[model samples]
Target: MASENDYINYEMQKRTEPLLGVVIHNDASELNANEWREVLINAPEERYVQGIAHYYIDRNGQWQAIDTENIAWHTANQIGNEQYLGYEVLESLSSTDEEFLLNEQETFRVIASDMIDYNLEPNRDTVKLHLEFSETECPHRSFEIHTNWKTTVDGIPDEWVINDLKDYFISQIKQYMLN
Candidate 1:
């Protein structure tokens, strides 16, 4: 019989390399962080293709479902599964709420801290959105709300990239470290 810890041990063994960056995703179900955790924990593990995300962020704040060293099942097409750490931001059922917004900002700060720890750049090289690999419009509201914060690339507006978002987080991290 497979031991209870077998899966965890297998996941750890499979992660032989360091993560390359971070991938941001949205949990479209409109559940808060804690509720989402309950759903994931209760659901069958095999339902996830890449495995569950390493972290989740919502009105209740950030929660780690899996260790960063383990590969998360957040990306589609198997893209960046082994190369990146993944985070899922909880989506509200209706209009976006202030609590969710605050949690989102906190999520960014966490990502920025991770970037500093991993020595990754605050740009496309280290930060990415789920849309970059899949056709679905995941993290939909997040993109919509942050459209004005986009950066220009090759003289064209690139609204979907996470560079500007990362930049903001990086600034926050700098300010935090200075204090």
Candidate 2:
């Protein structure tokens, strides 16, 4: 295995796009922040990686990732990958509803903190889901929780349903941002 310094030096690339805001995703695994970090930092290629997101949240709490300025290969959309910092909530698919809620809520708080730090207001434009830019059912946990609905078609969330999730997330983030 490669040493920590052997990969993901946070110097491999720099963001040329104007920093937009935050893009949220799910880790899709049961691993916590540290475990996910190990997986990502050691991965030999971006295609095989889970994340190097700016933050990871689990029931244990939130880990605001160390590298803030450089680009991370989280969002598949090139613009989002460069302009928006990504946050991963531990697991949506594997975790029970109760467990997922705990992790999701914790993610909200950390995102709120990052928003405040970056002077971003909580809204649809500032807070985004991975699915917003792609066809995947990413952030599936939040999609189900906020909309109380599932995919109507192929695994892709309906356009309006994703909006609902974004609204719910923004509201939650606002609650934390104010406090």
Candidate 3:
């Protein structure tokens, strides 16, 4: 029988790779239910084929977030890009509003629930935090953030790829580097 870690690692790898694009949101706590829903409804339609979302919470409180596989809206007009992942954190760096701590757990639960139906397992490698790929102080600085996000550093392993797959990724990397 496969160990729990092995199963988790396999599931994580499956969720992490084969994605077209990834979308990172700044923060989810500032938006209300309607606003948040609208954002989900008006997501981008460019290269966002598949994506995941992340959120931060202050001390792990209860929170509720929405999940929309198709519909989308933009908070700052950044959701137009298609084929990506999304995340919403429930914490604030500059502001100390207790409301920010509210519904965070629920948001995480809902996000996780959506992942189950997302046809992909929940894995840190596949899902990225806002801070991981961006230079902004987004997702908050005080909030304890999760870091398994696949930034440029945590790239896919060569051993994980077959000969053909390895060659394809290598070529792609070379092309990316050249460009």
For 1-179, candidate 2 gives per-residue lDDT tens digits of: 11122334345366777778899898777787667666655456553344467677788755554365667767777888788988888866678899988888888887888789878898888889988776677787677776776653447766687787888889999999889
Output the lDDT of residue 175, model 3.
Answer: 40
Query: Model 3 — which ten-residue stretch has the worst lDDT?
Result: 1-10
Model 3 TM: 0.39
Clashes of each: 2, 0, 38
Q: Name the TM-score of candidate 1.
A: 0.73
| Residue range 1-179, candidate 1, lDDT tens digits | 11011122223325566777888776776676666566665566465544567777765566676676677767774556777888777763453567556656667776777777777765666677776666656555565565543112222225534555546545554554344
lDDT of 1: 0.61
Clashing pairs in 2: none
Error of 1 at 80 (Å): 1.5
Cα-based TM-score, every candidate = 0.73, 0.84, 0.39
lDDT of each: 0.61, 0.74, 0.35
Candidate topping TM-score: 2
